[model samples]
Target: MRRYPEIGKFTLKVYYEKDPEVRADIQKSIAKYADFKQNVKQLNFDSSQFVPGIDIEMMYNDMYWASEGYIWEKIQDEKYDVDMMERDFLKMVDFWKSIYLRKEGEHDEGN
Candidate 1:
């Protein structure tokens, strides 16, 4: 029989109004977490695997207009479906930010 080592996992869900201001606020919170994580490493808990696994999903707010203008242009040129484009783009932004933080931690560990 093969055995697998237990792995740590954390799951978090943050739901808030879909306004740009709200999203901006969430972004700020994530930035703060990034700063905290950096500080922790500086104090030397410096394990190569110290990067925390983070996942966030934002509920789509119909009231918020993500793309104001160029809607048609986006649909025609970029083939972005008007209905899903904005929300998808924002989710992608959040995903990338998490990736950046993870890589930053990895860099701090010299791994």
Candidate 2:
């Protein structure tokens, strides 16, 4: 981020850390970019590298990063029924296709 100093890191961690053995075994897999950069590789998740979709202005209209309602938990909370989920799945496909990297001969498409 250009202003990481102003906005501290908001890391989204989604994994298990049960015990010391797990920590030792999965340290490499779970390591964040910052920790890896500090200890192993000097790489960063620079904000400039991420090119958001043109439709990002209406990003709220879609749920490409909706991790909540899709996961299995102690209590079930499915936001979409089977048919609705099917339709949303198609929309999700279209959304990804709209912004995916275009090939050499490909022209601009919807985003």
Q: What's every prediction's RMSD, in angstroms? A: 15.5, 14.4
Pairs with backbone N, CA or C atoms under 3 Å apart (clashes), candidate 2: none
The per-residue C-alpha lDDT of model 1 at residue 42 equals: 57
TM-score of every prediction relative to native: 0.22, 0.28
User: Which lDDT values do the candidates have, in the order given?
Assistant: 0.40, 0.40
lDDT tens digits by residue: candidate 1, 31-88: 6434433445554532343245432111111112333233434534433443465576
**Leading candidate by TM-score:** 2
Q: What clash count goes with each model? A: 0, 0
**Native-vs-model 2 lDDT?**
0.40
